[model samples]
Target: MKNITIIGGGLVGSLLAVLLARRGHKVDVYERRDDPRKAKPWEGRSINLVVSHRGWAALRLAGLEETVRKITVPVYARMTHDPEGRTNQLAYSIDHKANWSVSRGELNNRLLDEAERVPGVTLHFGHRCEDVDLDKATCTFSRKGAEPATSTGEVVLGCDGAFSAVRLKMQFGRFNYSQEYIEHDYKEISFPAGPDGTSLMDPNCLHIWPRRYYMLMGLANGNGSFTGTLFMPHKAVPEAPDAGFDVIRTEEQADRFLRTHFPDAYALIPNMTEQYMRHPQANLVVVRCSPWVHGATAALLGDAAHAIVPFYGEGMNAGFEDCHVLCKQLDKHGDNNWGAVLETYNAERVANGHAIADLSMRNFIEMRDLVADPRFLLRKKIEGHLQAKHPDRWMPLYSQVKFTDIPYVDALREGRRHDRIMEQVLAMPGIAEKWESEEVERKALELLDKA
Candidate 1:
């Protein structure tokens, strides 16, 4: 058994600790913040996450599937509400597969609890990672009102999130990294349950109000309430007209903006304006870094490796899969062979990290604008029909990403090819009225074969 040290006790770190501990490693998880179970760590920043297929596969690998499932609310479809309050529903997958909505704080706490239960696992909360010696696999941590201390292990895993200190140390090396802040910023708006504790909206479907430039999304909580997030540009550009976070400064402006663009959501959330003003407007950043591992002594995982936007809903899932991938590498090359395992892990996941980052950005466009477009809706119909007819040959890109464990790099490439093929299929005369017709299907299949 190897002595492994993990920095950050968040979702990915805690999950990695569990996986490593199960493999008989003496795992030490050092968290910067206080124990979240004692206090709500994500109280103000309550971003709800959806665990898709890859996330579940990782959890199953750690034998925590049933435990995590208890806290997730199944989301099978998306319910889009237009400005006029007219609603449309689209199933996420044709086979009735569902993604799970989980509160980030709750999930993390549960995983932390599970991690502590492992015999050789120890969790050190309130111990912030300060520095690292990459060559020696040693970390220095500091606590409030306490002297700094250093710990050494066989290997150090940096799961410390986007602004990781371990990653900071690695940045001094020949590493390549970039962080781009998206124009959009987000704030949470809570939707209370009905008087009887019943869901105010369709609990099984994710609720969306997609208004070209800005959008509001809601996911159900197990307690019958919903967590709604409004995403808007941080600053308005001369070419773009909709109000950005800069323009929506006052309570009156916030009220007007919510009432105008997301009237349905405004009606559902009682204190929309108050919550909008009270909650912090958090920016969305995408971080890309190469050479995720350093000489087998230390490596990065989860958000530390590649922090993508939340549009694709695969951020946490991708991070969880990182742990699963590393575990698989260890199994393949034996636990003691850290050199071979870390090198292979870096090679295998770096490109995938980049691919999922691109896919998430692409999905942001689809979710924010194309979701409400007539042509985009039509394309979804055509794609769904094609998949239904030719299950063996076709799977929609969304399904490939969310419903299966297909490599994200392959999925992104296939999605682009489907985009090209759909362009031709949609151009066929009368495709709007005859998308289900065999001729359209045959033409799509022929195009796929040709491509």
Candidate 2:
């Protein structure tokens, strides 16, 4: 068995620890923060995450599928609320498959608990990674109010998130990395349960208020409460007045904004203005880096390797898939053959990382602007009908990503092809009125055949 050092101890790191330890590797997970089980790790920022097919595959591989399921609320559809509070429900999958939502902090704590139970796993909390000796597979860590220390292992895995110190260390060598902070920023808003402990919105669906230039989303917690997030541009442009977080600086401004744009949400969330003002506004960043492995001595996983926008709801799932993929590579090449395993892992996942990043960005446009559009909704109906009629030949992009174990790169390519086919299908004469007819289906199939 190999000695492994995993940095971050967050979701990906914890899962990696469990996977490696179960294989009889001596795994050490060094985290920079206090253990969430001991404290309110996510005191002000409560980000909810959805785990889809890929995430479940990894959790099941680690023997934690049923354990994680207990804490999640199943979301089977997207409930889009209009400006006037009228709503439409769109099933996420043709077969009614669902994604599971869990609080980020809660999921991490559960994984940490599972990691701790693994025999060869050791978790070091409050230990911040400072620098890395990539060639030697060693890392230097410093904790607050404590002396700095160094640790070494046969292999080092950097699951340290987007702003990773290990990645910084690798930057000194030959490495390519890019980070783009999107124009959007997000703030969390808590939606409490009813007085009698019932969900205020449909608990089985993801609630969204799409306002064209910005949007608000809510995911249910198992405890009957919902975690809401408002995504908007950080600063308003001259062309788009009152379209950014800068426009909602004051309590009255926030109150007026919510009342005007998301009145239904405003009504559901008591003290909305107070919660909006109190929560911190966080930025969304898309990070892409190359050569995920460093000569077999070290490697990057999860957000450290690729960080995409959260619109696709695949951020955590993608990270979990990283752990699963790495473990599979180890199994294929044997744990002692670090060189071959790391090389194969990097070769396979790098393209997928880039592809999912693109897909996530594309989905952001669909979520923020297109979901409420009449034509877009019609297109969805047509696609769903086509898939229902021709299940062997057609699969919606969302289902390909969220409901199947299709490689993300292939799923993304297929999604683009579907987009092209749908463009033609939607442009057919009288398609708006005849979308449900056999003629439309036949035309779509013909176009698919041609493409």
Candidate 3:
């Protein structure tokens, strides 16, 4: 049996441990944080994550889909709001295979618990990997009180996050890497149970309050509450907006902001200030690199390799897919061709990672500004018309990309193709003129089949 070490027992790493161990590999997972089964980061801190088709398939492969279904709430659509508080509901699915809304910690704990049940999987908590000696296939870790421990393994997987120590060491040893940070900054907030002991927003929809340069989103929790996050430019407030019917500060300020900006939402978030002040605001970062694998001894996956903005709600989904792809490749290649298998895994996932990264960046604008604009709505209407008129030939970009199992790179390519077709059609004098005279529809149809 292959002995493997997985660094950083976050969601991805722990899941990887279970998957590898299930295949009869001896897997040791090293985690820096305390065990999630014991306790998690903070109370009432819900990390809003979307579990799409990719994530669902990943869980199903791990044989935990039923458990996930029991714990998750489905978000069937996006409830959008304008600055003036006018609301519009956009259905993500016509058939209602909605994305799952789950708390990050809850999901992590579930995965960890399942991983512990795997006979060959051993988890070491509060033991942080200090460095890896790739040449010797050895990993050294710093434990809480004990002397540093060392483990020798056939391979090491780095599923640590964006600021991965593994990636840092690889950089020091001369691996080409590049990263880009988008201009946007987001501060998260929460809206827990209120006076009536019921949810304020629709539990069945992912609610959004898009205010041009900023947006507020909320997802349902099992506790008859909603967890909300506010995505805005760092410039939204030099300090904090004033408190009143117009502006707000402190917990009182958060209450005021919610009541004013999202009156339909204010009732749901009781003690908004407490949720705001207590919850941590995380920064988003994107990463890319060459040679994610070093021989048969080391490789990187998940945020350690490609951390993208979460606008597309594919951060965890994409990471889960990474594990899926790796496992499939490993199954195909087997242990005899380990080197080739690892390299093929890197090559196969890198482009898809880049595709999702770009899509996530584009989605930020779609969420914060384009979703609120009249022209954007008009475009969507036209796109919807095309979908209805030519069901086989045309699908809305959103439907084609997010709701399907289409590869990320393929989805991105199709989205761009449709955009070009739309550009040509919109530049024409009239819709009928463009629809009747243009060859764009025929071309787009051909591309759709290819997509």
Candidate 4:
């Protein structure tokens, strides 16, 4: 059996521990934070995860499907609000069932609990990875009441998130690592249940209030509450850098900002100021790296490898899929050919990660602006009509990407192709010509086959 060490106890790392342990490999998980399950009232932190096919499939493979189902609420569609307060439900699927809203803390603790219960998995909490020596296949950690310690394994997986110590040490010649900070800032707030209160919004849908430069989003929780995030461009700030309105440094300022920008939401949240002052604002960025694996000693997964903007809600889903892909490759190799498997996995996933990163960025406009645009909707209506009339010749790219298990890279390529075809279709002599063009029909069929 191979000795495996996984850093980061977040969703991806915890799931990896459970998966590898189930394969009968000895797995040790080193987490930087305290055991979240021991905390009361879910105190430490809260972040919501949008669980779609990719994430759910990973949970099932890790044997935590039933546990997650008990705590998660399904989101059937998107409840989008316009600047003028008009609301519309866009079904994620034809029958409306789409994704699940899950608490990040709850899911992490559940995965950690299940992994610790596995015979071959050891859970080490409050053990922060300080350094890694890939040449020596050793990782050092810092923990309380103990001398700095080192552990060696046949392989070390860095799921340690965007700022990874493992990736830091593995940087040698020709190792390209770059991070692009998009012009966006985000803050999160939680709205608790009132007396005999259910969720303030529809619990079965992803709620979005898109206000041009800024957008508000909410996801349901098991405790009759919703966690919402406000995403806006940092350039939305006024000219004065010290102008208190632009800065979110204090409780009073946070309240004022929320009141002025998101008036309707201000009253829905209880202790909104406290939550804002307590929890730090998270920055949105796209992190890209090349060749995620270094020989057989180490590999990077999850956000450690690709940290994408949250617009498409594919961050966690993509990470979960990473675990799924890695485990599949490991099984195929029978754990003996680690070198070959690691290289192949890295090569296959980097392209997909880049594709999702780009798509997620583009979806921001669809969410914040196009959600309310009449022209965009009219185009969608026309596209849908054509799709229905010629099912074999036309299909909306959104349906293919969101509802199916098509590889992400392929989805992105097909989306670009469809966009090009749409431009030509729109320039046709008329709607009749648009539908009757045999060349267009043939290209559309080819794209569907690719999708």
Candidate RMSDs in order:
1.0, 1.0, 3.8, 3.7
Q: Give the TM-score of candidate 4.
A: 0.88
Query: Which runs in model 1 stand beyond 4 Å of their true positions?
Result: 239-242
lDDT of 3 by residue, 232-272 (tens): 54434544334221233466666556677766655455555
Comparing 2 with 3 on lDDT, the higher-scoring candidate is: 2
Candidate 2 per-residue lDDT over residues 232-344, each given as its tens digit = 98997676678788888998888888889998998988799999888999999999999999998999999999999999999889999999999899889998999999999
Candidate 1: the clashing residue pairs are: none
List clash counts for every candidate, in order: 0, 0, 5, 0
Q: TM-score of predicted model 2? A: 0.99
Query: How well does candidate 4 score on lDDT at residue 177?
Result: 84
Error of 4 at 373 (Å): 1.4
What is candidate 1's lDDT per residue for 85-154, written digit by digit as tens?
9999999988899999999989998999999999899999989999999999899999999888788898
The lDDT, on a scale of 0 to 1, for candidate 4 is 0.78
Reference-based TM-score of each model? 0.99, 0.99, 0.89, 0.88
- Tens-place lDDT per residue, model 4, 147-212, is 887788889999999888888886764588888988777777777775676777788888888776
Name the 10 consecutive residues with the lowest summed lDDT in model 1: 236-245
